[model samples]
Target: MAFSDLDFLEENFIHYAKENTQSNYANKDQVPTTPGQVKMMQELAKQVQDYGVKSRYNEKTAFAIGCLPANTAGVSPIGFFAHVDTVEYDDRFPIRPQVHRNYQGEKIILDEANGVFLDPAEFPDLRNLQGQTLISSDGKTVLGTDDKAGVVSLLAALKYLHEHPEIAHGDLYVAFGPDEEIGLGGQRFDPADFPGVEFAYTLDNGRPGDFEYETFNATAADLTIKGTVVHPGEAYGLMVNATTIMTEFLAALPADQVPEKSRGHDGFIMVTDAQSSVDRAHVGLIIRDFDWDKFLAKEDLVKNLVDRLGQKYGPDRFDLRLRRQYENIYNGVKDRPYVVNLALDSYKKAGLTPRVQTFRGGTDGNFITKKGIPTPNLFNGGGNYHGRYEYVTVEQMDKLTEVLVTIAAEHARQSQTGRDERPLKKYW
Candidate 1:
C-alpha cells in the first residue's frame, strides 16, 4: 500500500518516532526534558522553511514552539498540530519498540516472558492490517505513537512537497505542543501570534480513516458523605459506616454504560476516585457523552443520587459535592460544515474513505475550537490510545501526511473561484 516514491516518508517517519527524545525518554532517573519536544519543533520548522513555506516558531514557552505558514496567492496555509508529552506509563527508562516487519496477521509477541501478546480477540481490527507495518510496545510500556505518529505525518508531508516543489497549494502551520496528556496544550496558545490560519486540525485521532468533528461533552461530579464512628461492640445505630454509604453510591450507578462497556456515542459515568472512613467519605467521577443534553442530564443524575442518599441518611449527617468539566465541541463546528467538508475532502484525496465518528472523550481540538481556532481532529490509525496497548499502522501514517498536504492544496485551488466564480474539480 506504499505510495510510489514514498519510501522516504515511511523511513524518516519511523526514525523520527523512534529517535524522538523528549520529556518521555530514558535520559535519567527522574523524568528529564529530552529535547525531543524542542527537537521536533525545530526539525519541522526547518522543513517548512526548506520547502519554501512561510512559517514561525515559539520557544521558551510551556506551549513549546510552533509555526503557521502564510497563505500566498496559490497556497492555502493551514495548521496541523499534535502534542509531544506522552502519558505517564511503566517504561520510564530506555525504551523498546517492536516493529512488525510486514505484519502477517498473527498474535504479536510483546515481552514473551510476561506473556504480553496483542490479542486479535481484544483488538478486532488487526485483520485490517494484514500486510502493513506496525509499531508496538514490548508490552512493558506504551508505544508513544498516539501523537508521535501525528508529528511524523506532518513532517513527512512537508518532506514530500519539499522534494516535489510543483504540488501547488496553500501554506501550512505545523505545531508540536507539550503537556497535552496533562491538558495544557491550548492554555498558552495565542492564535493571533500566528496569522492566516482560518481553520486547523489536530493529528490526534484514532484509526487511519477516521475524521473527527465532535468530541465528548465532558464534566466531573465530586461527592462526599458523612457518618458516625463508635466502638463495634458498643455501637448500635450510632455506628454509621461511611465506607458502607460510599459503597451504596457506587452501587446506585447504572450498569452496562461505563467507559469500558460503551461504544461510539454512548455516554457513561465511572467513579474515577473514592475514599472513605467511619466519620466521612468522598467520591468523584467523570460524566462523559457526545450530546450536550445527555451530558447535563448525566450530571444532574449524579447530583440527584447524592441528594437522595443524604435525605435518606438525614441531610445534616451526610454531605455532597458535584462539579462539571468541559463541554462538547460539536456546537462550535456544527455550524461550519465547510470545516468538516475540508477534512472529508482531504481524506478522499488521500484515498481514505473518511469515516466520521464522535470522540468518546475531549481533545485539544475541542479546546482549540472554543478558543476560536475552529479545529477538528485527524486520525493516525492508533488504537488503545493513552495506554500500554496502543498500536498504529505505518501505512496509515504515510496516507496521513498526504492528506495533510492535499487538503492545503485543494483549498487553495478552491479559493480563487470564490464560490460565485466557479469551483475546483469536485467542488464545482
Candidate 2:
C-alpha cells in the first residue's frame, strides 16, 4: 500500500541531504548560526506555497512557518515541527547520498578504501528493510536524515491532502526551524507564529512504532575555581593548585548517575568539559532527570558539593552558575492526555503498534510544550541518527507520511464525534 510518492521521497531527500546545513554552536548569537540553514529555510517557505500552504520565513525567529487552511470547519488547528539543520559534521567533503533499490539484506559498501560499509549483521534493522529502497551517506559525512526524513514526509502528506480535498481535515500548521542541532532553535521560537494551534508533534528520531512523551528535565552548570599562582618551589601553605580542587569536585559526583550508566527514566550528572591551570579552573556540567524531585535533588547535589569545597578553600574562591535548559515534555502533556491519545490512535490506523517510551534526550517539543501547546514526539522512521552511518528507507518514510495523513483525518473525525480523553500511563 503506497501512501505517498516513493520517487518524490527519494528525490527530495537526496536533494536536501546534499545541502550543507550543519549548525554551529559557536555562532549561537546568530538566528540560524550558518548561512546554509537560512538558505534552506527560505527555500522551504517558497516550496510549501506550491502545495497549497500559505508560508513565510520569519527573520526574527528563524522559523519557516506555514498554514494549510481546513476544509472541515469544526476541528481545531494542529501543528507539526521538523528542523532544517543537522548536527555539526565535517564540511570538507560534501554529503553524497547513495540509494540502493530493492536491497537484499546484503552488505553495502559506502567507502571501500576508508573501510566503511553498512552491513545487515552490524545493523540488524536493515534485515527488515529487505526489498525496499535504502539511502545512506558516502561515509565522509552525515546523511542528514535526522529530521529531513520528517520534512519530506510532512511535505508529501500536505501535497496529498491538497490533491484530494475529499479526505476532510482541519487547519494544519508546519514550522521548519533552524539551529535545533545546537539547541537554540526552539528556545527562540515565537509561539505567536503558531496562532491558535492546540497541540503539535515533532517528527524527530526513532523507528516507525516508537513514540515518546517524556523527556529529561535539563539544566546546564558552569563552575569556576580561583587559586593562588605560586611557583612549585614556593612555601608549602601559600601555593594552591586550582586543578586539584577541580579534580576533587569532579570525583565527588555520583559515579552511578551518568549517561552511560543511566537508562530508561533514570537521569545523571555529566561533566561535559573541564580545563584548569594553577591560577584558575572551569568545569561545564549538565544535570538530567525524568522525575521532578530527582532532577531537583541532582541540582542540589552539585550545589552542596560546591558549598563543601568552598568551606575547605575560601568561600570567595568558588563561583557556580546553573541555567534551566528545558523541562520534561511529560510535565506539560501529562494532564492533556488527548494529545498523546490522538497520536497513538493515528499510529494504529496507520498499521503501527504504539510503543510509548521515555525519550532519554530533549527535543524542540520540550520547549514548545512549555509555551502552552502540549507537544509530543512522533517517529521520523530511521536509525543511527546524527552520524555517518545514518540511513532511512523510502518505505519507512512513506509510512511516516501515512501516519501524518492519518493523524489529520482522524483528528477531524474525532472532533465531530467525541475526543479521546484516555489517561496516559506512566511507563517510567
Candidate 3:
C-alpha cells in the first residue's frame, strides 16, 4: 500500500523549496531571523487549517502551531516539530528543484556546465533509491531538503490522518518553527504553546529508519587574552604578545579529543575560529559530548587552561566566558523509555527496521526536552543535506509519512491496552 500522497508531497515540497527561507546567523536577534522564514511559516499556519487542525502563527516566537484534537480517549497528547528555515546558502543563485521520475541508478548531472553530479559511487545511498522519484538542486545552491523534506512529510502525515479519521489517534500537535539551523528556534519555543504534550519528535536529519534519542550536550566558549603592545625596536620585558598567549592556550587543549578524531559516543573540544594580534586575541570554540561527566570535564579543561595561563601571565590578562548551548536529550528521557519505544514500535508497524543511533551534534529536541517534554529526533528522508549535491526520494518521504501516522495510531492503541515500557539500550 502507498504510504502517502506522492502528488501532494512533490507539489508541496517544490513549492516551499523555492521560497528562499534560509536562516541568517547574523540576524539572529530577530524572532524568525529572516523575513523569508516568517513569510513561509505564516503561510504554513493557514495551510494546516485545511487538515482540520486548530492552527495559528505566533508572531512572538515565530512558530506555526497546529493541533489535531484527539478522536480517541485515554491517549496522551504528543507533538511533532519541523523547522521551516533552511541553512544559509549562496544567494547569487536561485534554488530550482529538479525532479527525476523512476531514477534508474545512474549518475545524475546536477549542473552540466558546472560538472556537479550526484553519483552512486560517491553516495552509495543513491543505489537504494533506484526506481524512485528523486529531487535535487541545479548544482549552484543547496536544495533545502535538510528540513523542508521534514516539513512536507509532517504535512502529508497530518493530511493522511485527516482524510482517514477512522484511524484512531490521540491529540496530535505539529509545530513549524524558524531558525533551527542557527539553534535559536527551539531555545525560543514556549512549551506553553504545546500544553500537556507528554512527548515530541523532531523531524530533522536522518535516513528512513533512523531514530535518535541520544545527542551531544553542547556549549560554546569565548576566550580572550589581553596584552601590552609595544614597538619591537623599543620592546624589552614590557611587551606581552596576546597572539603568543592565545597560541599557547590553544595548544593546551586535548588534540586527541576533536571532531576529526571523535566518533560514536566520544566527546570533542573543537576550536571553530580564532583571531589574534599583539594587543588582544580571541578564540571561539564549541564543546560536545554524550556523557555528562565527560562533557563537564571538557568544560573544566578550558577553565583550567585559562587559569594556568592567567597565573603564568598576569591574572588580569585572561578572560573566559563559557555558556551552555543545549544538553543531550537522553538525559531527560533515559528513565522514560516509552518515548523511544513508541517510535521504534511504530517503525516496525510501518514495515521498517528500527535503527537507533547517536547524533554527535545537538538538535531542537535538546532545548525542547529541557522544557519538561522529552523530544527525540526522527528521519527527514534525504541525503547530502545542506549542499549542492543534496537529494531526496519521494518514496523515502512516503516512508516517513507512514512512520508519523503509525506513531499516532499506535500511541492510541497502546494507550487503551498498554505502553511499551521496555528499557532502552545504548545504541552507540
Model 1 CA deviation exceeding 4 Å by range: 1-7, 19-49, 53-61, 64-71, 74-77, 118-124, 232-240, 311-323, 384-389, 418-428
Once fitted onto the true fold, the runs of candidate 3 whose alpha carbons sit more than 4 angstroms away are none
> Which digits, one per residue and each the tens of the lDDT, describe model 3 over residues 101-123?
99998998888997899999999
Candidate 2 per-residue lDDT, tens place, 1-428, comes to 77889999989999998999989999989888999999999999999999999999999999999999999899999999999899888899999999999999999999999999999889999999889999999988899998999999998989898988999999999999898888999888899998999999999999998999999999999999998887778748998889999999999999999899988878999999999998999999999999999999999999999999999998799999999999999999888999999999999999999999899989999999999888899999877898889999999999999999999999999999999998887776
**So what's the TM-score on candidate 3?**
0.99
lDDT of 1 by residue, 1-428 (tens): 56523455456555665644435424333222455556666666665576555555566443433453433575445677777667766545444666787888888878788778897877888878888888887787777787888877776777676676666666567677765665555555667654777778888858877877777887777677778889999898779888998998899999876888988778999889999898888887888888888888888888788779878887775555555455666768766666677778777877888777777777777777887777888877667776657787778788787787777777776676542122212210
* Stronger candidate by lDDT (2 vs 3): 3
The window of 10 residues in a row where model 1 has the poorest summed lDDT is 419-428
lDDT score at residue 230, model 2, on the 0-100 scale: 78
Clashing pairs in 3: none
Candidate models: Cα lDDT each:
0.71, 0.93, 0.93
Candidate 1 residue 382 C-alpha distance from true site, Å: 4.0
Q: What are the clash counts of all predictions, listed in order?
A: 12, 0, 0
Residue 109's lDDT in candidate 1: 78
Instruction: Judging by TM-score, tell me the better candidate of 1 and 2.
Output: 2
TM agreement with the true structure for every prediction: 0.83, 0.98, 0.99
